[model samples]
Target: MTQPMVKKMSEEQQHLVMQSMDMMDRFYDEEFGLLRSSGEESSAHGTRGSAHYALGLLIRQKSGDVERAVRVLHKVLDYQYDAPEEIYHGTFATQSTDEHPPAGHYAWKSFAPGTAYFLERTFEKVSEAFIHKLQEENNLLKEEADVKQLRQLFYASVHGVLPPVWISYDPNWREFIACVCAIASAAFSELLPDALIQRMDEAMERAVQGSVDRRLSDAIPMNTNIELMHIFITHYYGHRLKRADWMQHADEQAEGLLHEFEQYGGTFAEFNTTTYYGVDLAVLGMFRRYAFTERMTEIAHRLEHGLWNNIALYYNAKLENLSGPFARAYDMEMREHSSIGVFLYLLLGKGYEHLTGMNCESGHDPMIALLGIDVPAEAVPYFQAHQGDRLVQKQFLELCERDDPKANRNLCTASAWIGENRMMGAMSGSRNTNGQMHPATIHWQTETGERYYLRLIRRETGGDWNSHLRGITFEAEVTPDSLNIDVQLDTAEEIEVYFEIKGPSIRHQDIQPERWELPGLTCTVKAEAPEPTMLMYTDYAEIIYRYVPGKSENRMRFELGISD
Candidate 1:
């Protein structure tokens, strides 16, 4: 009986442990006396020898090295990486550039509460270690101003306590604060006073139910939809927020969310646009949580595997190598890097070969100019990059299509971009010779390069599309030497196009170019508004707005500016 048959572990289990260990070691940096990741120094962004919260997270995961991880992370928490705000210092490399000097002070909301979260979690693990705990007063506000400021910062993470729209948009604050909330709720329960925890619980509940909560909507919160949701679901279910028995209510909420996904699925494409990154978060949440529902289970599995398992197994990548701004990778070969990169490196793997770059002509690299991001070298996936789109398209056809043999099963969610936006169908994609579109899903082209964004609008009558119009669209006729703008606003249900000249000097009168149907509400009715000097960003959009005679409320607007 070989000593009562205390058999060795199976190969599969051993493999799982090895894979997990590999994941653990993937982001560590023995050089530079740091554990930072790559890309942090891709640009001259952060501090010298500054540590971030992500390092703390890695430390906590390792069972035996809790104290060592805590010490390293504490040094990081105190260090500054000179980003616009506070963030977890993990992936992106911080080059010794004279460009972004450290802001003299250590803050939390800059990189979104990523590092703050790490701190919160460390506080708890140390407590659980039965190591003497640091008093909240001494540690949490160790360097914080007043207790009110500290708590407000904490709440801001959860409540989205900031302004709406981009003009004043600050990404650092939102990201740091939100991650901090995740830390407190998910892994740092012991750090908070009982009273503070109760309040945090309330703030979280308000997150899911507060669609009308101005606070939640007005300010953008840092956090990907999937991560924020993970925290929310964990709180609601783990602590039993909705029901006497918490797990029961969580199960119910999960089921309802999944059902909502089933009911309203097709609209995502209709409402999604590249300009607004919010849609990405929502979609990420939907796919991660309920991916395998009757609709897209297999596709979801593939996406998950691609992001985590496949990507990490690739070539030696750098933090700055990624297109996104914040690098967290702290390596021996490099210094500060993108925090998001290293954090994602664990799940997505190291081939940030994707974040930056495009395949376009040099002088007319519109995407590069518009997005203001680095054009990384063209690279393929480490594993099976080509395997993605075709498989997803097939899955979408089979599982998510409207005319599938399985028939309709709702397949939509309130969270879906299409359902929420309820905008018009704006033309998108690029153009071809002969002026005929390449069957691109949605496309836009500005021959004159003087339009802010291209748009495609629709109407039912010879009146305003609706009260507030829907979204922006892309449709214009451009020639080598001339651009013509025409939009037929049709409110007649029979499709009508109308012309209007409003604003101080908008139009002398309305210009309606050879219009036939209301579906096509836009064409190049060129007047060269202000010479396209005003530019924020331009992309394909579909929307409708109410016309109030002289206001041009839902008016089709476009502008152009110089490119990089």
Candidate 2:
């Protein structure tokens, strides 16, 4: 196999890369040979962080960096639980301060294949003599151990323990199983024993069969990231192992996904998510690099560009964040270093320093770097371009009935008003909850240049507070400076309307019993409810309006554009 040619990083991209490396350096424990978990006060070493740091160091390719990276990799390998009888065998701990730690159930999915990818690229890029020197300096191998032996040792450490665990555990995520098999086929097939090879072959066959079975019975889109991973792995190993059946399956799935994308106005089911979008891009990059057919490669390129274009449209240059109505999000603000921020920082380069949370976690930075992916050049302007008052609206098809594709349900309608100094976005008709959906959100720049965020939540009083109100139908009418929301519930239950706000120097005033004014926004509730209560904390505030059971319909309006 030939090494894929990667474009040289721009000077700005290199600077961001260096910035990431510096953050890793601060969190790195020299004694433990690992990176401390980000955003945690403890001195715990993170297995994924260590692996990602090693990959970052390898990409930097500075003097002494490779030796340091090798040490980190070895330490990470030591953290994996090797006990065959254990349920957690073949996986590495999520993080640990203990020298020998128990494995995390899902850790092997990312780190194992990721580390194998690192070694595969390392072998292709580095010289044998240099590897030998690093091995000697780290005392990783005997004096006479050849490069082949060292590679075998590293591969076995990660992949050798995988088959037994994979078969016994029988994880439901076929994409991850396919990933393991694909990497084995691509990098370590020769090093693996015949028995192990047979096991992997069987696993791959099972995964493909399962995917086929699902497609036969279901037409709704799969999870965006996982589907792409499945496509890439199938196509990748299909070509590597010369399996025509797997290749055909991948092609069919790829085309189906593309059709969905076209049918839904180019947005995925998990649309505009801060965390999963990064994963989506990473897998798409893999397709560009490894898909066996030209048509698949072209599909990957088109989707990759389209996703970046969406990123640009949602990006708020003033707040240094992507505006929401996020279909899914881990953090409301990108300043906290949401996964998408990594890609934005890479794209926006020097001016995107406000996204200082680069080390928030070992995000897809390592994988993106390995794939040599970049944001489309055309979308770069929108990310940093001068902001104007504009309205962007999109409608996405979420799912359809199995019998009739035209009988579409769960249409996600989203709209955003990007202002000169503020942005507000809202979505309706989405059934996603459990805190993943922020249906209505607003972010503004205060007079003092501080950024503030406010989002709406509908919750049943005694139910899961993190989730959106269940058994309710809601729709939001959004304009340039205001949002009007109407919610209808199925059952008579105590409901809470929450306006979660986060920022500095926040103050609120009650204009009326049901109307309140904050730093840069105002809210009015028109339900059969008492006065809204303001709950203040150190870094955030929540305005809660409680309604007793009886009212099944409610209306609330939020007016933005108030100056600080």
Candidate 3:
């Protein structure tokens, strides 16, 4: 009877599981505290409130608290509120202020209902055996306990809800909501009435069959999550829906999107290494786990490979950083390091040592576990590539070629200086915050000095030096210490350029007519308008150079000598 010894969990594995459960519990408690203190009454309404509640329920399900999970689900089913009419029209207000409420307050039309749909599906899976027992214990399955509210939401979507002006913007919201509807129609075939189920199927069709605005083209394609949702819907709900043409259009769109990396030498034109790329990679891995056609599956793999290649190009292993010459960023304070790659290891079983800095112990999102993916062996090349580079000049130069002069956001070039003494670059803005009341130019001086900031202002009657034109082109020749700028505007208006040198205790004395000398810095102003106005301060010097445009072009050169 010396048969086989029973297998047991390793001590380390047991410890990790316990630690993860503890983290999930704390996260739920914190979200509960926020809901209570913030005066948000219901768990099934509003944007952040509903999200917190749904997340709480999901955490309970993961922690084996099914009774509590069911209690929360009932609260959601019992919740009631007015659905905004605008949602049915597919139009949402973007502004949020003291007077106007956010569009997300109306759950059904603004992609807020997808969270509920997802939660409902999760409940079905985890409570399969306990469903009748739950009803027996608490009388949870009354006639009113039916999913009528969800049905109403589905009804509005199915019959072609249209706004006065319908535009194909925010594809992420539209696609995700539609995907959930598709999944729900299939999953709840037996539970829901046939009429409601038919409408759910129609809603899924309407969502995927919708059109995009051809006029406003995106720089990148619809994100990987949107693509994955399309694949999932097509795989599971295709037979119930009628959309052959739209599926063809999607393939074309994917082809066009993937063509960018091939054309740009393995990089997206706009290299945003922080939030957008990280989120895309994580979601893409999740969807890769699902079954799909061979073509779609290969596309998903190609997408992951390209994303990893781009990420690896910017990675700095020593500092655990994702360096950037980002087109649009959160603010002026640039990121020095990011550990989002560790999420790849957590979600997909790949890229383990290629990234560092993120702590996997704190990850408690149920979606990560529910949709876990395995990395293919083909993606190993991206991981094995060099992960550290001081300067990414070639990649950024490619981006510089595609910069739009009329864009309101800052268009930054690659690093001109990435050394022991300093790290710097340059950018131009039209009317953005960084532009500061005029068309602006900046030479990024992070480790060197405070910031060398400039803005081109229009000098007009009433001594008004505020407004700047939109149709202006800014071209630059950047060096380690100087930025030679050429400005050309379609308008003939007079513009004045303002420049300032900021640092710690920076004092300057006049060296020449237009040259100002400071400790470790020298600035010379070249104007095309009138006599320059110079103002000296304790920590900086401000110079105003007026520009009177000629027929062809106007030139202004700022020569700054840096010594630190």
Using lDDT, give the best candidate's number: 2
Worst 10 residues of 1 by lDDT: 414-423
TM-score quality measure for candidate 1: 0.30
Summarize candidate 1's per-residue lDDT along 1-564 as a digit string, tens digits. Answer: 121100132332222233433443443453433433344333322222222223233323444333343443333333322232322122122332322223334443343323333443443354434322323433543442353354555544432422212211222322222233334344445433465456545443433222112112222222223232333343333443543343443345445444433333322221222211222332333344433233333333333333232122212232122111001111111112212222222224345324222211111111111111111123234222322211011001111111112231222111100111011111222111111111111111134322121222234434343222212222333222222333323221233222211112122122223211112123343332212111111222222233333334333443211111
Which scores better on TM-score, 1 or 3?
3
lDDT (CA) for every model shown?
0.27, 0.63, 0.40
- Each model's TM-score? 0.30, 0.69, 0.50
Sorted on TM-score, best first, the list reads: 2, 3, 1
Error of 2 at 405 (Å): 13
- lDDT at 321 for candidate 1? 20
Residue by residue across 371-392, what tens digits does model 2's lDDT show? 5556788778777774567899
Evaluated at residue 380, the lDDT of candidate 3 is 44
Q: Locate the minimum summed-lDDT window of 10 residues in model 3.
A: 90-99
